[model samples]
Target: MTNVERFLNQVRQSSLGMKRLVVVAPHDEATLLAVEHARKELSIDAVLVGEEEKIVAAAELAGVCLMPYDVVATYGDSAAADCAVRLIAEGKGQVLMKGLIDTSILLKALLKKEYDLRTGRLLSHVALLLPPQGHGYYLLTDAGMNISPSLYDKQQIIENAVDIAHALGNDNPNVALLCAKEKAYDKMPATLDAVELQALNLAGDITGCTVSGPLQLDLAVSAQAAMMKGCKDPVAGNVDIFVAPTIEVGNVFGKALKYMGGYVYAGVVVGAKIPVVLVSRADSEQEKLLSIAMACVCTTSIPMEAGRMMPEMESA
Candidate 1:
């Protein structure tokens, strides 16, 4: 099995007794099916929050018996979001999974003063794509959230991706900051931000990853392209992560890779106290369940291990 597959298997074994989660909008078929599979297979449990009647009806239709689970009552989408948020705040649940409700409704509740889960930094949605064509997986970030991000917000976004990289056991994650060009120019502020991030990595401000930026897609993923461009940077090839300049770029990259290139993907919202599985309604049940499993493995990577070998550095 590949590293990620191994990680998922390890996650399934270790995620038992981790925490209680809340799944909002249990009325959705795909969402409920994913919950069912995860519950039957993993160590995770969820408190279903939504219209009680609809939730039960959908559960029954989908062959999910809710008798063993606690179902919370909420009248509508916003109410479901609020109830899930309240459950997390009350220490009844560790994370909130989106379901039938609109993403906007849940964001509204998450941003409220009482939720206590809000960080001052920008909220971004990151997706991980792996497929038969690609030898390893690549990341697409800030896709579903953060429509437009300033350089400052991009820094926080990079931190979020780095956290996941660390969890996956990549000490110096090769970060290709996706952009149109390969060099920094005064006219392009994004390139300047990319250069600044590289400096931050060298100064130890960014601890977990080796970042390269101002790279277009070709050079970042293809070592042949890197050689043709005469780009000697370590991150020019073998990049484990892709940090797009904005949400549009990331969103396009993700969908294109999946639809055009036939990739398998699993996504999670990082920077929370724990990883939040944020698969979309269009996602297959396998994708949703794998996302939860990935998050569980990431949770385990938080601890520091003794005598770990850090990635070797190459002088510029």
Candidate 2:
């Protein structure tokens, strides 16, 4: 069973080569510590983009030396984000990290036409959770992005997550489209969407994953609950990914696992030329570092199944 910490350790020691991680507007202590930690512990080269004076001050406060990194001076948070994205576009940086800048600012810079990071695909967030007492890890998707995804958007979201799962060595991850009921009802849109998603997977319209749908929370994770409810399906007892019907549901579900169920997690944004390490402003330093580790693994040397390259990082 791979826990979050173990996964991070593996990422740090994996034979795959390292890449430069650029931190945009790292003016806060948490962000500074996270970047420095990734640099010293994981051997990741780092570039810091922000007002240089403030970044220096933050580094001093965090007890991290700025001598080892490249510091790009930008006028504002938005400008810092733009500089970082431009660096990534030029292939100088392989991983982008969110720091003190607002997510909207970072995203706007990433989506700019000149940046060439966007591939006409929607960006989605995937959180890898180590449950307090679970046998293995679980994934939750779109918890921080795509407020109310359409069926097509959901398909892309699932594809992005499947890509991540493959990167993490799950060749054929089981996906569960979560809903309130195990059976589709026309009155409930999520249930209807789930059924369609399942059909698409069954017909090979969606590849590289096995998906089942319209599963309640209990049935998705608990074989005992599924047996008690008389649900009979291969996915009933085993689900690797939980595709929440809405941003609200995904957000609450991940938080419940963290705040109540005592889970630790690392989340990253996919569907760009490089994976985005996005940690909340309120996140702890450890959580932010974990996200950096996750991004490193996604961007450095992920060899997907069948000798395929990482589709998301492939040149457009």
Candidate 3:
């Protein structure tokens, strides 16, 4: 089985129990079908938030039996998003999913001060990718959020991605801060940030992961390339988290892996009170289901203060 399938199977066997998943603006056939699969296969209870008529129509179109689910009636996309976020804030749901609505609309509701979902950290997107030839998973961060993050924002982004890795059972993940060249140049800001982040990790300011950086893409994932380049960093070839310097780089790289390399992936928004499943509309039903399962695993396994420090890594 692929790493994603293995992870999904692990989630199913985890016995996390039936957690409620609130989908904002679930008025599309793909969304309905995915939730149906989640309900049946993952044992996840889905609360559909949107116009009742459109939801029912989409369910009918997708041949999904929505009779087992609770449907909340909302007039517009904003209303639906607000209602869904409200449900999550009120403890009625453990996970929030984006469905059919524009991501900005849903995220606006999620970030509202009245909802109280913010955790004093920047919210970033983390994509779990199964390489075409690998037996393990790789996480690419900030692809769908944080267009241009500062150095401090990147730190939080790393922490958020590390938490997801921890949730997936990797206690100490290797993080590679991706840059154009392996050497820090005055003209390149990303390489400088990478050097600083590496220092922070070595000094224990960034905990629970080993950070290596100013590494090109090839060296980050290929031991052969690192060896040929005389690179000696342990994380050079065995990275679990690939931190992109920008959203454009992350997005293009992730899409290339998906479209050209045939890698399967599931994307989620972390660094919040709860994990958010934010799959694209074009994402397949299986991808959406996997995203939900991923969120389920993260919701149950990761603590609110996850990535702050791993118990074993703490110096007593």
Candidate 4:
């Protein structure tokens, strides 16, 4: 089986037992179709929060029957977001999905103090990509959030991505901090940060992964390239996570892989009370379904503290 298929199968076999997925403003056909697929294929219960009339229309457009799902009526996008977040806070759902609502609206409601969803960690986006011909998955992080992450922010980003890697069954993933060169130069800040991050990982400050850095893109992913460059880090040729220096690099890298390399991806926003399935409207239904499954798996594995979800980095 392909790595994506195996990942999906693992999620299906997990003992999560019918997680409830709350979708905000699911007034679009893509969202409705994805939720329907998740409900049928993954055995997930879906709660759709939006205008009932619009949801019914979307269901019809998508050829999805809503008889088996719960539909919560709301007047507008803001109301839908608020209602969905409130449901999750009340433990009515285990996953939050972004649908037709503006991301800003959904995130605003999610960050409200009343919901108590914040764990004081930065929220970062992680995309799990299946290469066209590769045998495993690659995680690309901070693509949709944290535009210009400082060194500390990058550390949290890596920790968040490591949490995802663990959910994917990789207990100790190989992480490569992407840079333009294999050696840190005085003028290149990213390369310098990469060196520092590698040192932190070696010092037992960053846990659960083998970190390597100051590697160019080719060296990070291609064993042949690493060999040609005389690089010796084990992570050089077998990276499970690629940490981008900036959001622009990550965004362009992910889009290139999806648009040009024929890679399928499942994306989620981590460091929240629960995993958030956040995908573009243009993404295929398969992508959305995989994203929901990924979130479900994360909900079961992410650690909790004092009755609240706490990221491993925070508790570290």
Worst 10 residues of 4 by lDDT: 307-316
Clashes of each: 0, 0, 0, 0
Q: Compared with the true structure, what per-residue lDDT tens digits does model 3 show for residues 1-316?
A: 8666777788888665869999988888878888888898888898999999999899989998888999999999999999999999899999998888877777778778777777766778888887667588899997777776789889988998998888878899999999999888989999999999999999998999999998898998889999999999999889999999988888888888888888887888877788888776677777788788888887865445322210111000
Better of 1 and 2 by lDDT: 2
The residue ranges of model 2 lying beyond 4 angstroms of the native Cα positions read 300-316
List model 2 lDDT by residue over 1-316, tens digit each.
Answer: 4465677677767543557898898898888888887787778899999998999899889888889999999998888988999999898998998887777778778877777777545778888887766456888997888788889889988998888887777889999999988888989999999999999999998989999999988888889998998998778878999999988899889888888888887799877768888777666666677778777777743222221111222100
Error of 3 at 250 (Å): 0.2
Which candidate wins on lDDT?
4
The C-alpha RMSD of each candidate to the native structure, in angstroms, is 7.1, 4.8, 5.7, 3.8
Task: Give TM per candidate.
Answer: 0.87, 0.91, 0.93, 0.93
Indicate the TM-score of model 4: 0.93
lDDT per model vs. reference = 0.72, 0.81, 0.83, 0.84
Collision pairs in model 4:
none
Q: Where's the lowest-lDDT run of ten residues in candidate 1?
A: 307-316
Off by over 4 Å in 1: 1-7, 13-17, 133-135, 298-316
